[model samples]
Target: MNVATDFPLREYNTFGMDVTCARFVQIDSADEIPKMADLFDTPHYILGGGSNTLFTDYYNGTILHPAFGGIEMASQSTPTSEGTSSSSVLLRVAAGEPWENLTNYCREHSLYGLENLTGIPGLVGSAPVQNIGAYGVEVKDCIEKVEGYYTDTMQPFCLTSDDCHFGYRDSIFKHELKGRCFITHVWFRLSPQPRFTLTYKALAQALEGREPTLDSVAETVLAIRNSKLPDITQIGCAGSFFKNPVVDQAQHAALLNRFPDLVAYPTGDGMMKLAAGQLIEKAGWKGRREGDAGIYPKQALVIVNYGNAKPEEICNVYRQVIADVKDLFQVTLTPEVNII
Candidate 1:
């Protein structure tokens, strides 16, 4: 266990808010988990790649960062109870592995299922927590199991896909199991057969004439994301600050009548997912800035720090955007990024 005091967190979080943690502990491997009993007694923050986190204030507790890293084929083709070959491979990825790195690896190996999730930032451990999705694909669809250690008992546990209770932008890690465990690794099932999901219009249009393969699909997704989201290296921002709100059919109908161009996607259920960005843009907050914080003009869903913006300034901008959207559309917008 490597420990540091008054650790600078500006570099740890993608938003680039300058903040400090009281204490920061870096666990290099699962073997170090047993020695961290003292940390469990107090409230702590588990940090991954920090891509989806916004630090509204300095954290006063311990920050636990898992640095364990490895990736290997955990299982090969196996027969199921029905005597049919599964035709899938299980991969064990360490919690600290960059999410994009894993996607690139799968593409290079001709693996399917993760191609659409390329360009998403963060670690494998954080993926299940957010149930990260893009281009018509969610990580939950490929997750087989999540391995972690319970903070209270310091005991290791494994939860299968069904056990995760994954929902849109959510999982057990973000709800019932939140803050109770430290995820060490995750298992994903990938297919050998060529499978492509090109339902998203932008992606389909990008690959109009080209044959869709794992590489082509992944590249297109990355390109689409890059065209919209600001590069974190150049501009400090968290991608998609707000989640697309899901409303009942009646509310959807009323809103659609009011705003003819209201962008929405039917949930195939009674609910309709309204585009949060469209609401913000319509509310006239797109490209607007307060202090040093501003919404990315290209994508209204993103909030960026122009320079040395304080956490409160960024948060103020967020609040104003939320208020404007709510007042204009009578719809509530919730943040997808974790605000700390």
Candidate 2:
């Protein structure tokens, strides 16, 4: 275990908020989990890859980070179906594994199902927490099970996918087990067979002429992401700050009448998910900046820090966006990124 006091967190969180935690502990082994129980005496937060996190100010508490890393093949099966082999592979990825690394691994192994989620940042453990999704695939679609220990009780537990109750960027981790569990591993079921979900319009159009192979699909997904989201390595920003607002069919019809160009997707329950970026862009906030903080011009869904944005600046921009968007669309834009 590595411990530090008054640790700088600028590099830890993607938003690049200049902040510090009272204590920062990174454990490399599950054996240290028991030791962490005492840390709960003081307020503490579990941190992953810091991709989907925004630190609004100094966190005057312990920040526990699990650094254990490994991706092991736990099982594999090949069933013959009318002379055709339906091969499947199961991988157990440690929480500390970079999400991109997992996607890359899939490509290397010719694994299907993670291609569309290629460029998302964060750790594998964090994947189920937010039910991370992109293109046309959500992390829940590939997750077989999640393994972790409840921080409050220090009892290890594993939950099947059905128990996760995943829904549009949400899972048990964010609610039922919120602030109570430290995820240690995630199990994913992948296949060698070539199966693709190009249902998402943009992704489909982008690959119009090209064949949809694993490499091609992953590369295309990354390319599309690069065109919109700011590279976290350079600009300071969470990919998409707001969750795409979902509305009832009646509301969707009302908005569609006023704005024919409105882009939306049906959620199979008369609920239509509106494109948040389009809404923000139409609100005339794109490329707009408040001092150092601004919505990324390429995609209005992102709030970025131009070198040295203060926490208040970021808050100001997003708040104003919500207020303005609400005034115009009557649709509430909620943040997808966790603000701490």
Candidate 3:
């Protein structure tokens, strides 16, 4: 365990918020987990990649960050004498491994299932917690199991994919296990052969002329993502600041009557999911900036920090966006990022 006092978090989070926590504890190994029981009695948060996290203020409590890293083949059919893989592979990825690394690993090893998730930034541990998804494929579909420990008991635990109770951008980690569970490793089952999921229109269209292989799919997904989202390395912003608002059939009908061009898709159960970016753009907020905070011009769903924006400035802009969107569409916009 490594501990730092008043640790700066500007580099830790994607938004690059300049905030500090009273204590920052880095767990480099599983042995340290058993010794962390007492620390949980105080105010604390288990932070992973911090890519999906936005700290609104300087934290007065401890922040535990998992730093251990590794990727091992938990199970897989032996490669044939000719060196051709015969079946799916299982990978046990450490919680701290970059999500991008895992996707790249799949592409390099000719593994399928994670190619579409190529450009998403975050630690592997945060994947299931956020149920991170892109281009019609969700992480939950590949996750075989999650291994972790209870903060209170410091006892080891494991959960199957179904036990995670995954929903649209939601998981048991966000509710039942939030603050209590500390993920150590995630087990994923991926096909050795390509099993493409190009149901997403844009992804399919982009690869129409090209072969739908692991390398091509990975490259295409990253290219499409870069076209819409700003590079976090240059700009400070959490990707997709708001979730697509899901409305009932009646609400969808009402909106469509007024705005015939509205983008809406049935989400079953008589509900429709509207494109949040479209909503924000239609409301004339795209490329709009207040001080250093603004909605990304390329993707209205993202709220950005141009340079040295304070937390309140970012908050104010997003709040205003929510209010304006609500007034215009009567639908409340909910943040997809974790605002702490």
Candidate 4:
């Protein structure tokens, strides 16, 4: 266990906010989990890649960060009596492994199913917590199980996919089990066979008429994400600040009639997911900034810090965006990023 006091967190978080923690602890191995159980008695925060977290103020408590890293094929089942083996392979990935690095590794090794999630920032551990999704694929679809240590019990546990109770950008980890456990690794069930999912319009257009390979699909998703999201390294920002609002059929019809050009996607069972970016753009918030915090010019879904913007200023801008969207469309937008 590596420990520090009054540690700066600008480098740890993608937002590049210069906040300090009272106690910052880094655990590089799973064995270290038990040693820090005592620290859990007080308020503590478990940090992953810091991609989806907004440090709103100085964290007065301890920050536990996992640095464990490794990836390998965990197990394989035998062929069935019909002479066809199960095409799936289970991969055990460490909690601290970079999400993009895992996807790239899968693509290079001919592993399928992770192509649609390329270029998403953060660590593998947080994927299940957020149920990260893009281009019509959610990480929950590929997750077989999540392994973690229960903070309350100080015991390790494994939860299967069904046990996770995953939903749109959510899991038990974000609700019932929030702050009760710390993920140590994830088991992903991937395929060796070629499978392509091109449901999103932009992704389909990018590969128009071209044969989609793992490399091609992954590269296309990366391109699409890059075109819209600001490079966090260059400018501090969380990729998407708000979750797309999903409404019932009647509400959807009412909004559609008002805004003929509204971009909405069917989420089945009489629910429609409206594009938060489109709503923000229509409300005249795109390319708009106040002080040093503002919305990204290209994508209204993103909120960025130009430089040295305080967390309160960013929150103010966020509040205004939500208020404006609600006032104009009668739809409320919820934040996807965790505001700490």
| Residue range 134-228, candidate 4, lDDT tens digits | 99899998999999889998899999999999999999999989999999999999988888889988999999999999999998998998898
Clashing residue pairs, backbone N/CA/C < 3 A, model 1: none
In terms of lDDT, model 2 sits at: 0.91
lDDT of 1 by residue, 1-340 (tens): 7999999998888889899999999889988887788888897999998889998887999998888888899988956799777688899999989898899889888789999999988889999998999989999999999998998899989999999999999888888888899899999999988888888889999899988998889878888888999999878998999999999989888998999988888888878999999999999989998878999999999999988999999989999888888898898899999888
TM-score of each: 0.97, 0.96, 0.96, 0.97
Give the alpha carbon lDDT tens digit for every residue of 165-275 in model 2: 999989988898999888899999998889999998889998899889998888888898888889888889988999999999999999999999999998998799999
TM-score of 2: 0.96
Candidate 4, poorest ten consecutive residues by summed lDDT: 75-84
Worst 10 residues of 2 by lDDT: 79-88
Please, what is the whole-model Cα lDDT of each candidate in the order they appear?
0.90, 0.91, 0.91, 0.92
**Candidate 4 or 3, higher lDDT:** 4
Candidate 3: regions farther than 4 A off: 77-86
TM-score head-to-head 2 vs 3, winner: 2
